[model samples]
Target chain A: MKKKLYDLAHSRAGDKGNTLILSLIPYDEADYPLLCEKVTPDAVKHHLKEIVLGEIIRYEMPNLASLQFVCHQALLGGVTTSLSMDTHGKSLSYAFLQMEIEV
Target chain B: MIRIGSGAGFSGDRLEPAVILAEKGELDYLVLECLAERTIALAQQRKNRDPNSGYDPLLEKRIDLLLPILKEKKIRLITNMGAANPIGAAKKIMEMAKRKGIHIKVAAVTGDDVLEHLDGQQEVLETGKPLSKLSNLLSANAYIGADALLPALESDAEIIIAGRVADPSLFLAPMIYHYGWSVDDLDKIAQGTVVGHLLECAGQLTGGYFADPRKKEVPDLARLGFPFADVGPDGTAVIGKVEGTGGFINLATVKEQLLYEATDPTGYLTPDITADFTTVRLREIGSNQVEVSGGRGRPKPATLKVSLGYHTGYVGEGEISYAGPNAYSRAVLAGEIIQERLKDQFPDLRIDHIGVSSVHRTYFGELREPYEIRLRVAANATDSENAAIIGEEVEALYTNGPAGGGGARKYVREVIGIVSTLIPREKVQTQISIQEC
Candidate 1:
């Protein structure tokens, strides 16, 4: 339910649209080692934690290994916003499971 | 006043229905269609193998048809032709225009290719492969949306060159400028984009790859047509192929094309229109054309991801069907003997499922038990020749090894590839500048 990750998350540099497009961009295999060096365990933890909020925790999905955070923000706000994106490889789906909000 | 127009699909070729319609009818806007995943991969490989190949730059080939018209009609254009090398393409277009004494000013949209620019920053998903795995990753492009075209339009450039923008927006963009359409009017924008999408692929909707290719009775086969978008002030755009062409359209052609690449009609995705594909309706109006109307859409997805593929490695796979109760044991022995023989020919090759569970049992219909076992062998080889050799190696099993070789047996070889890619959400769309001459 975090706004930054939901609103601001993007494909890394050179990959400007979505996750799938980044992977689709023909990249020189020489740069692959650079990718391994960048995915340090700490980076994942920090990035995942940044998207976490009250009653919302970050979790990676099965088979996808994609970072996702579950939340009750949709329920708390008494409003629903649903968005689904498919990139032959990456996908995102979310709904309100629970919530808490004041007027 | 310069009338800048971007079309829906491939209308310039004069072979597709879109082009036929445009040539037959009078229109201000004609868009062509040419972007897909398979295409992206093909174009990228073309550029990867040879940077100067100009495989991705759409405008270069696009100019074959466009240049003549722009000169004839004295019109302005904007297009997403910057597939691989936009700047290179722009240079070519400029050179062509100069020969005709046309002072062509083209705005090449740059800042999109981020592959080489990543400054020590790169990330991929869990598969554990990043930019490095793509050892030969030569080029990268994102499916940039319509907004990218704004800069070029404002410049009043004689032509605007682009790469990977949403197809509809390519046509809709000029409409946005001509009609002064706002971003908030999601409905109007969606309507305009549909016109673009409908005509993007030349023969797709125009009867090229229609359900029944023969029903339309198209004219000339050699000059396959392209698509054109003719939009009015109200956003009611009429789509058609070129005149003097072969293909004809009825309600069926339009309806089928609407459903092309659609599992759910209502969710047609585009940067400009989150089209409501569910309530779409089309009607045949004339002999060779149909009127496309009544498709509503929602807002665009928050994040649009570009797709990419990497060559993981070479894979060799094949299987054989075994019969009888000794299927499991026999399949195992067969695999072992095959691997042993292959190892000698293919040194340092890795063979999986060599012995254990070499066979999977299955039956037809609902109620079925392990009817017979199908044994499979998959090997990974660095060399391409090994793949064909492995097939011959596995098929040889029936004659040379194992006890219950079964009644009917065979081996098939298929190259295996482990493609690993990384896509961060924000970085999916890339913008590259198409320089002008």
Candidate 2:
């Protein structure tokens, strides 16, 4: 499970050009872990690292321990993009199903 | 030309830009969306920080900006900038308009900020918390139905101003009066609601930061174009964006906008329109235009929407990063230590989640478990001191232990709580204020 999450994170993000940012504004942090399950611990830490890029917007966490994490940035298929590299086949498929878009 | 045109836009601490658009287009009616659900606390916060800051933005600034424009342009506008402060908004608008060389007739419509008025008048579809608890609240602005717009309209004032009315009523009120459509005329009201809904969010439908966000090199989104409706007597209306604008609109844009800020489609409720979204059609026409037609709305509900969030306790946390060889392992140890200790202190339990990435693995991880665990432990103590003490104790762990990698402390304090409100469409609806400004 750990290896799969790790590989998915690398192959999908971390190249460092296509910056991806997520804002935890849903007013609940309970579902945050569930989101990061697909990614490795290292990837989560690296992206959420305060020093990474321009900004990482997280909400509702007033006294936040770490402003950054290897939380999954994906909606369904997995963490989508940012900082690394990965084939978006799973991502595209997931979105296609969720929205039923023709693409 | 006594143009009876109708459209939508924004109204916050300012209504100048909206008046400019109305005057430029020679529009007769303008709808402005000022208040939102999560904004009351924001309003309160602003009030606390600067007694004249929060709601004043929706009033003081509006008067200075619009008074002059109202004098120059003979247009009527309505706004829902009045959350717990319509009289404040109205008084400013009236006084400002007069000073700006405009002899504007205006009336401030109330009956929406019913933190008190919702006595037996309230019914709860959810938990039924009752209007009493809601009273004496920091602020109360009901989402009024279009029925509230009647007063503003009946006053025959060149402009009618109101407090915390729903966003749609800004447009619906004017349409009802011009078309003489009764509030109960669900179908017509639905059309008006549809128009208001489409135009209420302003540049959103015309391609603002939408859900299906399309990044267009619009001429200027900062000075974004608002929506307008050519509402007819039958409740049917033609809606479009500004003329010679950069963005283009069509059925797709309307549908995208319709579903952009999405919720349960069936549960779409605003005080003005009882119509179900299932009944409308978006027919494309000119490049930036779509005609919104066919609406079958329902009757207004008895109760206003409820905005509820209680004073939960306080919480705080600290952060330290792990980077070297055993960074991941060290991070986990740190999380366990905090969790184990917190268990003895606060049983609610502190939560820690771990994720890691590398140059090779991207963010999810590189073919293995996370390389580093970002540990975050949180606890709710009886008081802020209790919460801060726990957070500080965790901060100290990094200095003496292998688990801490980054530093001695990264601590911050704040009251975190879930803010939820199930306001009926009626409670959040914008009361229409058709002021000549």
Candidate 3:
């Protein structure tokens, strides 16, 4: 079955310089393994191809059932210089949650 | 156990929540983490214009509202609202106390401003270019840690103000002081840092930013209460908010805040300690109460991170709304016209269909044509005059192109760019000056 990542996880995005840090956590601990296998850095890079212009590095926190994606050069230069309406990219988390994952 | 409440998270956070915490919450301290990345830089710019005006504009207003309650409650106040001018802010507070006939002791922690220490030859962490390469540099301040704030805390000052102190440090300094924890205790400092990181954002732990309607509902967001941590001697704490106030604190809220801006889970670096978030534990003990413990840490960094703000250039923006049938297409046409008209002058123009895809640059799921679409055109230029042209051209679209282009608005403003560098810890000096009224 195909299910959206939003069904399994919730996310919040924060920015430092030109990098966007997006934290992904599963609602159920049992779903952690599934997300870990499916939501690879390459997969996320492909998912937000247009939005992120740099590398995406994923850091896992097994204790918290969370995955942190550090997307570099992603804020379109960053909050101070970015011309985007959402300069902080606060809404990018929702965009990441909308990704389709196989269940 | 000592309770500490977060008054304000950012420079422009809601004031009422902090007031509620000061009045009702039984807290030993109230800390407001107001300095953001570019905040002090802008403050420095203001200081350059007028020496006494660089402090947080709301410092006076915030102190005015909370002073009486804080005094009655005997809650020691700590804040980084002293951005670019800790002494000036402290003086203002003392003056306010004298005028109001309130007895209070205010201490200003200075020396975070390391502008003179930088020769501009150092490399900028973001661009990897020599700092000298950047022109019109405005400010440079190091992210001082908990240790720098210890002097003021030890002085027993009722209010402590500082500039460019790391966000978590504002919360951790209180713990170190009250617990009498040694600065060398990396594990204890790390745990305190965790509490600081979580509570520094104020309402975030109590659900100010974490609402999603039916998916994740937060109650009474309008009256969302700020959070406080009850810290024990061991550095473990229970996070809670005032009862009967809006917003709920639970495992979910605590979990979200645990890694708010923590880039690395294992190696979240602050000047006091390199905190390891993976070691932390979160459990819901009761309604709106979560027990947080098990945070560990490694040794502190050898150098402090400095945020440098410089003149980037100018940004010109314009927005116009199109309505009724074929609004999306008409909005797209209006954007195309602006792009074609200003391509040579402003080559890097950005056009956004606000209603459809302004945020993420693309829409998710099925796309439905919005009845009302707002067309936004923005671009950056070397000078304000060139930037103004971007908006001027969009304003001309009212009659020059597109049908029903109503509610057009334009803006042009200077942009400040922030970058980071590192300075040896020994090179930065901190001092404390106390004033009583």
For all predicted structures, in order, the TM-scores are 0.57, 0.63, 0.99
Global Cα RMSD, each model: 15.2, 12.2, 1.0
Model 2 TM-score, all chains together: 0.63
- Of candidates 2 and 1, the better by lDDT: 2
- Please report the interface RMSD of model 3 to 1 decimal: 1.0
Q: After superposition, how far is residue B62 of candidate 1 from its true place, in Å?
A: 4.3
Q: Which candidate is the best by lDDT?
A: 3
Models ranked on TM-score = 3, 2, 1
DockQ of each: 0.02, 0.04, 0.79
User: What shift in Å separates residue B18 of candidate 2 from its native position after superposition?
Assistant: 3.5
lDDT of 2 by residue, B1-437 (tens): 12233333343422334554665766777655666554554565555565544553545555555556655676776665554455556666665666656677776676654444434335433334553443323444556667777777777776666655667777777777776776778788877777777777676666554322242244455555556666777766676655754445655456545532323233357765555655666676676767778766777665566543233455666666676577777877877777766788777554444354222232322335455556555556657788786667667776755644665443434432212233444434334444444
> Where is the poorest 10-residue window by lDDT in model 1 chain B?
B356-365
